[model samples]
Target: MRKKLIEAIKAAFLSEGYGFFQGFADKIQGSELTLPALWLTPIEVAGMSGRNDGKVTYKIVLYLFVQNEQYDEQQKEEKWEELERIARKGIATLPMISDVISTDKVTIKPDEFAFTSFGELSQTVTFLADVYFCNE
Candidate 1:
């Protein structure tokens, strides 16, 4: 079931002309990811009962990375604008996932390391997806 949800997310991002990865940035070894990428994987899964059908909640964090290439003042503004646009689109796309019963409001935080080492600006968006699975 988790794999099904992951594939659905990949397909949705692909349809939007974006690629979705299934793990964290630190986990990648030698592969170079294209800038403006999205990454997510289930960080936690909990089972709950006492409701209609038992529901499992998947705690997911979605990350978006944008290349912070050198740019003029005007271009800097454009870069920030592009980041905001992509983040908004990602938020809107979450609840549309199949079997997603609810999603909590999220806060997208900027990664501070962008100014130090990585020349790419990234944002982390976190939310929980509750899914009801019927007993077989």
Candidate 2:
């Protein structure tokens, strides 16, 4: 069920014309992914009050890591435009990926860029969604 949600996210972004980006559900190794890539995985699932088939709804935090190449500030405004576009599209794409069950609002927060173990500059955009997918 969680796996379906992950795939749905990638599918949504691709169908939304973000096919240029790569999506991952596990820890990426090396620098396998090119710039503007994304890593998505379930972090936690907490039970809530809503019931589904006698199961409790859940609040899930899906981690999204956006990897990118070094940004050259001696660049054009469109470069900035493009980055913002990616962020916006990423945020908009996940909410529509409620595969296992209906999902509530999705909240996304893109953190500052950090160097990954692979030495690539990446940003973490944590997406929050509430659904009815209990791990059981």
Candidate 3:
């Protein structure tokens, strides 16, 4: 189930012509991030109920980076909007996974101070993927 979710996310971002990575190191260095990238962090997994047939949910946070060559506020906001659209499109597929039963809405927050030194704008997108499975 985790693998499915991860693949879906990668496809979603990759379809939009951006790079996808699985950690914080590249995102923080700014210099390391290839502009127009999504950094994925699988935060936690928790069983939704005690019953064996119950659902299990996982939390994921995606860090989106887009280049802002001149550090223009208008361009930054536009990039944020674009990233939000891509995030929503990705979240919409959670229910399509065979084991996935539901998903929370995508929550996006702009990091105004993030990676400014490298002329990049960043945003954080968070969502929950809930699935019903006997074993993960």
Error of 2 at 8 (Å): 1.3
Question: Which ranges in model 3 have alpha carbons more than 4 Å from their true place?
Answer: 24-27
Please tell me which predicted candidate would have the highest TM-score against the true structure: 3
RMSD to true structure for each model, in Å: 3.2, 5.3, 2.7
Question: In every candidate, how many clashes are there?
Answer: 0, 0, 0
Candidate 1 lDDT at 26 equals 64
**Reference-based lDDT, residue 116, model 1:** 23
Clashing pairs in 1: none
Give candidate 3's total backbone clashes.
0
- Candidate 1 per-residue lDDT, tens place, 5-61, comes to 676566656665666766655654343567656777555785565455588887767
Residue-level lDDT tens digits of model 3 in 13-132: 787787888865444664466778888875579547757677778888888888776746787778788878877777776566345677785589998676536667788888887877
Deviation in Å, model 2, residue 134 alpha carbon: 9.7
* Candidates 1 and 3 compared by TM-score, better number: 3
Error of 3 at 121 (Å): 0.8
Instruction: Give the candidate number with the greatest lDDT.
Output: 3
